[model samples]
Target: MDISRRDFFKVAGSTVIGAAAYSIAGGFGSALAQAPVVGSTQITNGIQSVGSKAKVYFTKHIDAAHLIKLYDLINEGIYGKVAIKLHTGEKNGPNIIPRDMAKAFWQHVPNSSIVETNTLYKGDRYTTEGHKETLKVNGWTFCPVDIMDEYGNVMLPVRGGRHFKEMSLGKNIVNYDAMVVLTHFKGHAMGGYGGSMKNIAIGCADAKIGKKMVHGVPLDKELDEAWDVVYKQDMLMETMAESAKATIDYFGKHIVFLNVMRRMSVDCDCAGTSAAEPTIPDIGILASTDILAIDQASVDLVYASPHNKDLVERIESRHGLHQLAAMHDLKMGNDKYELISID
Candidate 1:
């Protein structure tokens, strides 16, 4: 039988509470204290904390069964007109998060709408009309889909950035009182990996100025030239970190993050038709209040996995891990985190 979203949550709520209690009672907290450290870094309960790591929750189940429960765990302090930010995937893209899973999550969130920005590259999501058409094709009709950049852009202050003074984002982003960053964890042709940071910086930014700012290119610059201009890999990573930090600052404590580690592809959802298949197996879903911790934890899990050679190579070749250090420098959140398994 197909489980309804409400039904999924009922069981998931119980399972999450039970599992969390069991894990806590099993000396998981003590293990974190006793866990050996390598220079103030410790890996305990599936966590690798920087200086006392943030808490990241994980579950092996990939479906709504796990996501709904994981959602409950990290959803604290999130209220008021919520914006569930995520990639609706491109038309014909098979690796994006399943709509059914999103449907389940929507049931648990009140007054929330799925929000996204148009793409920079020419594709189905390059323009508002085209993007809306693609949303239907991608099966995202279960909830309200807001194309943030459709109306116009807004200037978000980038307080401490090397390349940009301000970021251009969808003006309507300010409409939401809280944000839920729902990211599909995967590889990218450029960044090597796309998770919370990429999703916020690239995914949240307006297509024109915001994306160009991160790419270190001019708004009128051609796509071909844009890549060449930002060839300094660390610049791209740092700029992405800066843009992400700006978005984070805008929301303050009114944001939470979730990364679905299914469809472990070597390409981001933005690649659309060109995205490669999963060379690594589906890890699971993770949620955390800290952006850096969640992103760092995701990378740690991938590296710890036995089947991470391909993804690892992709990340290293593109110097994607540098984003973590850049984010650390930004003091976005702790790279160290305790990975609490709610399974």
Candidate 2:
């Protein structure tokens, strides 16, 4: 059951309650880890407040004007060296957000550069060189693409949670004054769904250690030994919420999010060549200052879609709603957001 944010934190108290970890295949063991929570009007650090409904701007045009319009709605407060964080689709991956679609926005933001990190798994993006190669192949050269982890790694503290003390992130993340989370909304092999939360949590973390930590892979274990160990789904999802919360805390109010609902695939761009064909039609683009609000709105739209049977089944089978519920537990954003269409 979904609880109120005030009640959630109140119940959690100062005690860090560690719930029993269960295998993903055994079903979402306890809703305790992924329980839902309502938003509060009172202002809180690293969380949104606009009554109960967070203002999520949307546009169905998907053209340059609509893109810029949605961006302008919440583009304030971002200044200095800005990092436009996004996924440059994997080699042979066709579901990623196109560079051309974002060209106008890229040009509008001064001193902004595209940023990303190497992947945890071995593939085109496993190494900096290979990742850059795929970036060129995928036509993301409109701006300088910085492979964030190439510099090194750093730790950011995850506040008010039942996880590790700190989350490991790419060292280069601190180099920028602000960030724009550009996410390609889609299904995932794990985590049930991918949106702004996953973009910053896994996308901003360094390939090896940071990614492993979010996956619940032991620090001492190598990549090969870690995969099998990190398969406990809810724990990993909870860790992702913690990591995303840490990232939001690190950047504070200087970060904003935009999610392109095009190419509605049941697999993440990270899946690359093995991704399944998209059955759900495009749902347009959404932008928001609230990470949880935007992601929640997107998932709700999918649930309401008549053509989303395949995507819905994919999400349900993977128990993906747990990610949102976990984010709610962390007070990341409001699940009940008022979506404003600019069509």
TM-score of each: 0.85, 0.84
Which 10 successive residues of model 1 have the least lDDT summed? Answer: 24-33
Clashes of each: 6, 0
lDDT of 2: 0.75
lDDT of 1 by residue, 53-138 (tens): 67788888899878988777766667878999998888989899988999989888999999999887888898899999999998
Expressed as tens digits, the lDDT of each residue in 1-343 for candidate 2 is 1125324433332211122121122112111111122322432223454455676888777666787787777777578888998888788788887777777779988999999999888889999989989988888878888887886676656766567556667767767777899889998888778889989989988876778777876656667776677757777778888778777776667788889888878899988878988988898899888888889888988887778987888777777888888887777767766677777
Q: Lowest lDDT 10-mer window, candidate 2?
A: 22-31
Candidate 2: regions farther than 4 A off: 1-51
C-alpha lDDT (0 to 100) for residue 56 of candidate 1: 81
Cα error of candidate 1 at position 271, Å: 2.1
On a 0 to 1 TM-score scale, where does candidate 2 land against the true structure?
0.84
